[model samples]
Target: MSLETVLILISIGIAAGILSGLFGVGGGIIIVPSLLGVYAFTHFNSPYIVHIAIATSLFTIIFTSLSSAHKHFGHGNVEWKAALYIGLSSAVTVFLFSKIAILLPGEILKQTFSVVLIIVALKMLFDKKGKHEDPAEKKPEVFKPWLCLVIGALSGAIAAFSGLGGGVFVIPLMHYLMKVPFKKAVGTSSAAILITAAAGVISYFINSPAGANSIPYSFGMVDTLSAVPIIAASIPFARVGVYINRKTHHYLLTKLFAVFIIIVSLKLIFF
Candidate 1:
């Protein structure tokens, strides 16, 4: 890769990492598209490269989220019961869907994943417009096994296709569905992302074409070589994002972020 490509990847990593930490997201939305942006700029034409990028980003999240989760769990904020419920239910779905994801052409998967990001982000933004996590909201009912499994399954499917941890969905579910406190929901979601992302990545590796190149860290695959710097730099920035999240008026920022995601998704789908 050229110097320009390297720099672009580094930028994507740091930026995505910060976003991941601040919002407790998986960073796939940013990483996958940023890989496309890298490909567009570098003139690479490998079909599965974007897939690799998404996979690699998910792999990276395994570490990033673990670290973040551990730290947040330090505050006794993580909710083990809820996270386990979400992870268990979704495990089967993530496995099945990741296999399906491997079968589709990489380009289509890339575009579809982008669209998923757009839709989820829009939901998040709109949700934020109202009370995001009102303590006054109703409490979760008796934890039904089926309901938990269904939600977990949905999260897995989303992660399998889009490389997100499903934390975006998970947090809201905790808030609106389970009546979890906002901070606890965020902590639980971060932990949940680790489990769900790990399961999805394993499925991706298993279902992809044989050989090193099919998964992350291979030549054109997940491009871990390119994604590493981003992961490293994100450590500092993620903390910053978390701090900023507590202080800033997130309404405008969330809307702006959502608009950007929509524009980028449109470009990838059409351009």
Candidate 2:
């Protein structure tokens, strides 16, 4: 890697970190697309190296989520019980699906990745942000443990394959199904991403092919050089973002974020 490339990666890291903190996402929203552009431009194909980028993004999220989760947890907003149940279920699914992902052709995987990101961005755009706070009207409990598990499992599988932290659906699921306040659900979901991201990283290690050339300095699929800066930058900026999030409505933030995702996605698709 040239010094110019390292500098570019650093700039990407700072931007990703700021966004991750603001949205409670893994910053793969930024990382994966940026990586795809760079890789395609540079023509670095060490067999399934895109998998390495996804894996590396997950590792960075481990720390980013930890810091953000702790902040939300301290606010008494994180639903540990729900997060744990979902994490366990999703981790298993991620492990299974990741094996399949490794076996697919590389170009197909990129297109699949692009499609998934498009779906996520569109979902964010259309997601109804109902009044976050619930009234005293007696609403029946809607989510059972098994249902939560199912949701988590799907989240895990998708996150592993697409380099997402699964915040897109998790927030809506908890709010609509369990009557969790939007803020609380968002906090808890951020915490859950920590586990889901870790699970994805582990699965990649188990599934990564031997003698794959894209992994220059990696154990399993994580590219440490790419991940280290993301973690370092995301942790502090995310803390600031969390603090800002406390004051601003996350719904508005989500809407703005969706627009950015769409713009970036279009740029990548066309470029």
Candidate 3:
């Protein structure tokens, strides 16, 4: 790859990592779409362009999510119990669905990904931000293990299919359905993405065709040149994002998350 391409990949990585930390996402939201654009604009023109994008995005998330999660962990925001249950449950689903995803048509996968993004954005946009309860006054309901498992499974399958970090749904699912505080949900989701993305990367590697990497220095569907630079660039930026998340209010985070989902959705649909 050219030095110019490496620089571009690094730039993309920096943005993705920051967003990953900021939103507790796996960085796939930025990585997948950006990679797709890069491939398209550079005229890579392979039938596996979408697959490559998703696979490479997932691979990058392995590093990005871990870095972001570590920051959240340091802040004591992650719910370890929830993360454990969700991550393990989702791993199975991600593995199974990823195999199926490889068999599906690329256009169908992209369209489905777009639809899911739209749904998530709408949910975030209209979601009621109820008044925060005083923690000292009354304790919230117990976090159900079964519910966490089910949600993990669902999120994992969808993430595997769409090359997402599963944060789009995972964060909202925890906040709305599970009654987790937005900050906690974000932290927990980041931890879960660490597990889910790893499973996705492994599955994609196994299921992908032997020569799927049309680009140089690729492993299966993952483009190593892009993955390395992006991963490196995203790490420190992810810390910055985590710092911002700690200082920012939840409402702002929600709005920003919603807007990002909408923008990415439109790009996927029209681009």
Winner by lDDT: 3
Q: List the residue pairs that clash in candidate 1.
A: 13-230, 52-221, 52-222, 90-152, 90-153
* Per-candidate TM-score against the hidden true structure: 0.77, 0.81, 0.89
User: Which regions of candidate 1 are displaced past 4 Å?
Assistant: 105-133, 136-144, 210-221, 248-271
lDDT of 2 by residue, 90-184 (tens): 78877787777777633454455456656766775787744462421235536579977977887786677677787655765676678776567
Ranking by lDDT: 3, 2, 1
| Superior by TM-score: candidate 1 or candidate 3 | 3
154 in model 3: Cα distance from truth in Å? 1.8
Query: Which model, 1 or 3, shows the larger lDDT?
Result: 3
Q: Model 1 lDDT vs. the true structure?
A: 0.67
- List, residue by residue over 203-262, the lDDT tens digit for candidate 3: 888888866877888888888877999999998898888999998877777878888878
Residue 127 C-alpha lDDT in model 2? 76
